[model samples]
Target: MGIADLLSDVWGTFSHPAPDAEAPPTGGSSTSSPAAESGAEKEENKKDAKSDDGGEQGHRPSEGGDEEEEEEEETVDPKDTLEDECKESKECQPAKHHYDECVDRVTGQIDNDGKASEDCIEEFFHLAHCATQCAAPKLFAQLK
Candidate 1:
C-alpha cells in the first residue's frame, strides 16, 4: 500500500470515532472538563472584579499583567521562525547550498538505484556548523 493508505489505516486503528450527528446529547455535565469548569469560574471571578470598581479583569492596574498576557497570546510558528532565522544568516549560504546539492544528488541516486551509495553527513555537518556559528550570537542577543 501507498504511504497515504498506510497512514489512514494506522489512524483508523488508533483514533476515536466521531459521534453521529443524530445521536442524543448526553447530560450537560458529561461534556465540561475540570479545566473548562475552572476557566468558567475564573471568567466569573474576573467579571466580579470588574464590577467591584472600574478596573481591569483578573489583574490590578499596577500589576502590569497585560504585557505578559499579550506576550503569551503572540505565538510564532516554528517552521516560519526557522526559515526566517536561516534566511537572515548570509554567512551560512555557501554551506547550505553545498548541503542542498548533496541532498539532491543523493535523492537522485536513490531514485535510480533504490539506495544512495553515500550519505550527506559531511555536507550536513558543515551546514549545521555554519548555521550554529551564525545564529548563536543573534539568538543569545534576543534572549537578553
Candidate 2:
C-alpha cells in the first residue's frame, strides 16, 4: 500500500481501535478472544495456569540462586581473557608481533584497485594458534 494509506491506517488504529479490540460483552454466549484481555487479566490467567499444574508453568526462581550468582561472578569477556593470557605468554609474543607487522604492511600497500594488495592470513593463523595454545587451558577451566 501507499505511504498515505499506511499512515491513515496507523492513525485510525490509535484514534479509533477496531470493535474486536474491546472485550466481548459480559453475560453473553460470546467467547472472549485472548487479545481482548487486559494486562492484569492476562497476569491472573498466568497465575491460574500455574495453579492448575502445581506451579510448573509459573515464573519460578532458579533451583539455586547461588548458581546464578556464581555464573555472574565468573563471567569474563573472552576477548579480555585471551588478551590477558597472551600478554603473559612468552611463546605468543613473536607470533603476535609478526602478525601486527604483517597487518600494518598489508594495510599500507594499495593496488591499482585502491585495495590491499596482500592478505596476512598465514601470519594471522600463526598468531591465533600461539594465542589459543596459551589461552585454551585457562579459558576452558572456567567452563566448568
Candidate 3:
C-alpha cells in the first residue's frame, strides 16, 4: 500500500530485529560520499577556472594521499546543521508558528520581562529535531 506499509512488511519478514531497536533514523546519505564528491568536484572546478584564464593548461595538482588532512576534519555545529535541513522542506509551519507564539507570548505578558517565553523555544527545538540532516551543510552554505 503506502511506504509505511511496505516498510512494516519488510521489517516484519526479518525474524531478528536486532538489539538496537530504538536506533535513530538514518536520513538518506552516506557519511563519506558527499564530502568526498564535494572535494573532487571542487578540485575539478578550480582546475577548470585556471585553464579558462588563458594560462598554460597545466596538469592539475593531484590530491596526493591527503588522508591526514581528511582525518583532521572540523566538526559542524548541530544548530547550523538543523537550520540547513529545515530550509529544504517543501512546507513547514512549526518554526514560523513557534516564532509567532514567542513574539505573541512575550508581547501579551506585559510583565516588562525582556525575554521570549520558554514554550516557544521548546516548540521550535522539537520541530527542529524532526528535520533530516541530509541536506543541512549544502543548505547552510548556500544561505551564507
Rank candidates by TM-score, best first: 2, 1, 3
Model 2 alpha-carbon drift over 4 Å, by segment: 1-80, 111-113
- The backbone clash count of each candidate, in order, is 0, 0, 0
Which segments of candidate 3 are over 4 A away from where they belong? 1-89, 110-118, 132-144
lDDT of 1 by residue, 1-144 (tens): 899999999998679556653777766653235555477567666666668875544533537556554445777755446545774578778888888899999999999999999999999888777766666666766768
lDDT of 2 by residue, 13-130 (tens): 8998687787766785321577667787677767767578654543555487765544446766885778667855788889878888988787677534568867899998887777
Note the residue pairs that clash in candidate 3: none
Q: What tens-digit string does per-residue lDDT give for candidate 3 at 33-54? A: 5564577576675667766866
TM-score of 1: 0.43
Cα-based TM-score, every candidate: 0.43, 0.43, 0.26
lDDT values, one for every candidate: 0.72, 0.74, 0.62
Which stretches of candidate 1 lie above 4 Å from their native place? Answer: 1-84
How big is the positional error of residue 134 in model 3, measured in Å on the Cα after superposition? 6.9
